[model samples]
Target: MSVILHLFIAILSLIVLLLFDYVRKIQFYKHAAKIPGPKALPIVGNALRFIGKDSSAAHDILLDIAERYASPCRLWLGNKLFVGIYEPEQLKTLLTSPKSMEKASLCSLLRPWLGNSLLIAPVPIWRAHRKLIQPAFNPQTLRTFVHIFDKHSKSLVQKMEEELEGGEFQVGSYMISYSLNVALESTMGISETSDSKMYTRYTECVNRTMELIMVRGLRLWLHPDIIFNLTKMSKEFYKCITWMHTTAHSAYDTVAVSLQYIMLMLASYPDVQEKLYQELKHIYGKVIPENLSVATEDLKKMKYTERVIQESMRLFPTVPFLTRKVVQDLEIGGYTLPQGSTAFISVIKVHRDEKYWPDPLKFDPDRFLPEEVAKRNPNCYMPFSIGPRNCIGSTYAMMEMKTVVAKILLKYVLKKEKIQPILTIKQRVEIVAHPVEPITIEIVKRLPNTFNT
Candidate 1:
């Protein structure tokens, strides 16, 4: 009788503790009850809704939720609360806040791949590193990179001349190679001729790891480190990360993806391409200069080219979303987002919001003109993001893009090629948004006397 009484008492104590914890969680939920969101179930919350879904599908669901609830809505991933903000007005409050500078918890998933680099470092470390690295992208430094950019772009043009024989070819593969070469040479100080095979393998691994991480992020079962490590995916992820560390200090996945989109958009819109070509011709006339070295002043003069790049990014941002964690209780648009909550900024939806962008689907480079840009909220257009944490290399990226695009346009005219699917491209979201199918385009050599330099 004594033993039975002791066992019963222990079981009852455990039950009471669990009930107390459950009550605490319920109280926490009530804090955000006023905020709009999908109906969340007990224990699992919204986890089941995203289980087994790919990143692309998950992205669509997020956009749908944003549309339904509008800005400053609540989201539950398991027990954690995420406040989704899509409107520029609400975004300005979150993005510009110094307290909300830290990356969201979801970014911790990239630890194995990116390590504690500036992209995902903690607040103090990130600030220090940002200060140190800011000079690397200064105007003087970026001007030097223009030479490197031109040299690699010329190599890409030469390769295209040799390989593109009138038929259609996948442009993405070539663009990736070109961008990788530029990234390695300009940033890592690694020349394309040195350790070419290692660079190729490392890039392949980085790409694969990004895809796996995206899949793992959606599946709640893989959240715990112990469970994630026990799987084959984790094994491969670590292996790639190890190889990447040995080869390069940084990754240019964003630059590669951006180039792919630029090429695709140029091919899809012939009139846009023609206008861009005309701009390039005005800069460098009929006789193409064999030794083409674009100065910073020259790049500044290419206003139309810059506008085209901006417009392309508006339609297809390399990073479709950006996330930050709230370090303190904050009120925005009438709702209180408690401390420790994650805030997601949907760059894609905000860029396409009809309220700010009239005919949002149309490809119009003029939207980036000074007067037009001034008409809307500054935060509305954030391809490289805005505020203090914005991309440090935005200028370098723009210069590199301009040089590469100019070189290609000077040599060849890109035409849309027909495949079975007819290039009805859908974006696949990994670390960056990528086209579901390879983008292939037909290239024709430009007439010799088209422009006079």
Candidate 2:
């Protein structure tokens, strides 16, 4: 008799919650109706657009919606409202607001792997953890890691020797390995060689686990904890995680993704590459790139190299989208985003917006020239994002990418394998935005002493 009474009470509570949810959604639908978006079907809303798409296709679908609609437009994702903020003013309002400081529920998917890390922690927890992590990324501390960057980069170049005359080969593997080696050795003090059989297994497992996490993120139906646990994907996901060390770092994907893009861009634009090589020549005079050991002080001297890296990031931001949950009625892009709707900021759209950038598709590194940069709105270019919650590792990432790029350019001539415009390249945005096809470049060793300043 007691069990029957408990069941009746539970069913009553569930019905009450469902009724409340239905009423709550009316306000979202009302506002979303006023905003511009493709007409959504009942119940599922616009989820049909994402139903059969792969991650890259799903990414393109989102990009299409952002491109077709103006900044203040809305999309009904299931019963949820997602406001796309692409205009500069909208970005300023959403990014700077304390009310919008909370991450969207999608970020919670990372919690199973990352726990309540800085990436998905609540505002209060994030603030505290960010403060704690700041010292580790300080300029002084980052300078010390220049050696780590320098060491692994040289190893990276060596790993590509088989491909020296081996024709066009994928450089992403080399770059990812280099990124992992440097990050592990420096942060976790893992000196296990990235090339060793055991370390390779660990790296492979980590890669597979990340890929599964991305797949789950794309397939929205698997988002519920209970439902996800019932599937084979969940089993595979846990198996990979079990194989990985508890400390497998996930933050370095952006670094690896960005580095690969920069290498390809350099390969495509030789004149730009030549200019960068000249800067390296000026700074590291008589020091052959093959044997070059970049000092803490030398990092600052690569001004042109920094610009090249900056331009590459603008064209191909590793993490192109940023999402936050609206905590209250928020005014942005001339629209009122109701509380509980998600604010989806497309940094890529802003980066490619022709208003701020002339010849937006061109690969001109000089666009980042100080004089040119000063003329535009500061928020116009946010490869590492902007406002209070911007990426903390921006400085570290820049230094690391610059170190690797400079080292490689110093030794080998990276001839472009695919002669195509920057945007013409096929791309995928799952865990990170990267080319769908492997970025291939011919590796011809630059004759020693040819460009010694």
Q: Judged by lDDT, which candidate is best?
A: 1
Q: What is the TM-score of each candidate against the true structure?
A: 0.92, 0.92
RMSD to the hidden true structure, all candidates: 3.8, 4.3
Clashes of 2: 0
| Residue lDDT tens for model 2, 223-303 | 899999999988977776666646565567788888888888888888888888888888888886776898767788888
Cα displacement (angstroms), candidate 2, residue 258, comes to: 0.8
- In candidate 2, stretches whose alpha carbon ends up further than 4 angstroms from where it belongs are 1-22, 196-207, 451-453
Query: Local error of candidate 2 at 54, Å?
Result: 0.4
Model 1 regions more than 4 Å off: 1-27, 194-200, 418-424, 451-453
lDDT of 1 by residue, 1-453 (tens): 699999999989977875786587564556578788888886567878788777777878888888888788888876678889988878888888887889988889998777778878988989999999988888887788888888888888887886566677877767777888888788778776545576569668877888888888777678789999999999999898888888776767788888887887787787888888888777776656456666677788899999999998998899988899988877888887777789988999998888999988887889999999999898899999888888888988999899888888878888775523212456778878887777778788877656421
Which RMSD does model 2 reach against the true structure?
A: 4.3
